[model samples]
Target: MPDQQRHVAILGAGIAGLSAAYYINEELGPAAHVTLLEAAPQCGGWCQTMPQQGNSWFECGPRSFRAANGLETLRLVHLVGLQHSILLADRRMAMARFVFLQGKLMKMGPVSAIRQIGVWNLLRETFVPRRSHSEDDESVYAFAERRFGTGLATLLSAMLTGIFAGDAKLLSVRAVFPLLTELEDTYGCVLLGALCKMVAQAAKAVAARLTGPRRRSLAVAEQWAKEMKRKSLVISALPAYVLADILQASTLHTGANGMDPQAIMVQCVNTLRAIPFSSVAVVGFGLQAEQCPWPRSQMGFGYLIPPSEGQEILGTLMESCTFPDAQPSNVTRVTCMIGKAEHLQGSEAHLVAVAQKALERHLGLCITTGQSAVGVAVETLWTAVVVQRRCIPQYTTGHTKRVAQLQELLHLNAPQLSLAGQSYSGVGVNDAIRVSRELVQLLKKNWA
Candidate 1:
């Protein structure tokens, strides 16, 4: 069969799906006919950038991209001719992260010196025992506490909340922070493992500089065509539950050839549905330059509130500080993320008010009590609110095992089907690109 006869149906138009389509087109070219399916009117999934009243930009979803695991994303940027538009924030500026503790926004310094985390706790982690070989998956909180100390474990909970908007006590340590677990499993200690890895990375970087990068050539068109027997490829980048719902509907129509295939599909669907998702309310505010209460020196990426603080907001990001180009010179922008699934049920105005109160308590920002009100707090020139329900997937305990099972079932019963997106692997723009590109590479290899 000719390569041109092959068809690829990509479900969802999110970053993962789009990247998969792009890479498939780039690598396979006319070899494959790609059909991108998106249920929504707009694409981009949870990555929406909106224009504010003051010519500022408010991200209704994800705001910034991290450098780590972002090489593929950067490559995509260059491929799409967006390299010049990129704005780089100072490394120091991006590194300054704060944690709200005991009604104070505390600057979280290095773990070794931070009094909140305790110097003794750091010293004690080295002597802490590792998990037994028979032991399997455990909650993030449990792993942290067992490896480090209770204080550090508590802090990890807050950090997890900021990232996943999830409870660390429920999140899977192996699934969420695989590197950390691998370090412990291999080196018997997290800190020691990290240091060793850093040294290895430095050595690797030096070696890379000494010898330039080497690119591999793609397989010839003729070879690919000959190897390609699969007529259609279906890559699903939808949320786990959505995909499960789809599978559920499809299975009802499938004629059961045997009990095994039908049973596998049912198991996969149930596992997919079991994966929980967390909701978040992204509230953005555009303010005049003078209205920002904090001095420029004190401003950093933003602050995160630990669940211990008993605050409504998960965290706040200083958007203008990190990406000055995102907003006009006269305007400053900041975003607050409130992630309590129940709280999202409130009206938009009510949610805005909640965010306003949070900002006021955390950053001393002004709040509008009535139609007309004045106070020491600085008022916002404009406000933007976006409530994302069941947005972030929660990698609860046994997530990795569940994913492994799902993969095994799919491989046996549905070889043409593949899964990608935050639901399966890492959650970020970089992860999305990396996963999609990898899937395309795998498809190419299979066909070749």
Candidate 2:
């Protein structure tokens, strides 16, 4: 093959796009010309950080992520030279979260720990699993209730509602929790499947240790460097619908749609309109170290409030406890989230009031109108981060056939393009990273 320079245009500057640029440039080197473009002025779409007063910081999107997914994120952090800045949660101090059941906050405790163990219920949940007759028709709520019983389902529904700001009954189980579905299919019960999976994972870890670090798609530093070089990519790391529009506008020709590509693209984009994201105002209140309500010595992550409580704000995070250096000396940072998508039409003042009430209810802490009493209070912080992702893309009955059709259309019509993102697989930072990496490889093999 000739050493022809491959010019790749990346559409968005989000994590996925940035990661793609890095991979293409670093792995492909001078053989590829990578350009990264953003619709917004800045990079880090949702992963943005802003300075707060007196050694405090605020994250517009994700503050911290668990390292459970593997070393991809850790590698990125180290490659970005943020290793020293990485703050690990104090595991011992980290308390189990609670649900706002009925009207009170109930701490999450194992049945044994809570001293309310139902042996029959536990046995059924552990051994018996519900089987779905249809391939792609079960909702998240139905699946959960079937597998874990009503109590666990209710508890999880509350938590997931807060996470996705979505209706549990409408969300697809396959799209939202593919692993869970797989476990049920393979082992009949989630608990049994998990036990088996854990044993296999342990064996794999041992094998990996013996084998040493395997070659990844691309190193983090290389990816970063490539991202810096690209002006933009034609397609993006955004949802398929979003990319479809861009592709239609671009010079790229899709034979399937023929002369009416733009119209077809619009139809595609409109086919699965994103679930309206709720505007959330995250208010952080800082109190003097002496006035902090929770244990000062015992550092740990904060708690969440379930919907059953009829609370305004979703949850609060104990910033000082969750991350070291999150707050200054003699100051405690409490983060509160208000105005979820479900309540987007609610007034800002109403949201704030609800947040205040929730804070009081959960932590026995009050937010007073005193500058001296409150070190900092960020009101109505603007963040475009959508709360309700059209999670569980409507994979109705015969959804597999539909996806297969779409795949066929893409191959036959738009060979230069590939669909990727949270919608295709799962929604998580790690999942997005994995998909983007795979897409990059696909692009290289086909277009490069």
Candidate 2 residue-wise lDDT, 1-448, digit = tens? 2346656777677777777777776567777777777887898766677776656666656576777754566776777688998777756545545566666555666752223224555667776645855645576777777766566556656666545555566666655665676667767788777787788777853553333211121222123223333222344567555665655565534456354665545544544233233345666655554444543432346655545556777667677666555565556666776645555555556555666667766655556432222343333222122232332233333333344445444444444444444444444566566656766665555444
Q: What is the lDDT of residue 233 in candidate 1?
A: 77
Cα lDDT of all candidates, in order?
A: 0.76, 0.56
The stretch of ten residues in a row with the least summed lDDT in candidate 1 is 213-222
| Candidate whose lDDT is highest | 1
lDDT of 2: 0.56
> Which of the numbered candidates is closest to the native, going by highest TM-score?
1
RMSD of each: 5.2, 6.8
Residues 1-448, model 1: lDDT tens digits: 4635689999999999999999999988888889999999899999998887877777888766776757888899999899998888757768888888878777778752257667777788888888898888889999987877677777788788777899998999887777677778878898987787688777754453222211010112122323346658788999999999898877532423454656767888999999999999998888765434565445789988778778988998987877766667667788888887667888888888888888767766664631112222344678888888888899898887778767756654665677878887677788788778877887776766
Candidate 2 residue-wise lDDT at 340: 59
Task: Please report the TM-score between candidate 2 and the true structure.
Answer: 0.77
Compared to the true structure, candidate 1 yields what TM-score? 0.88
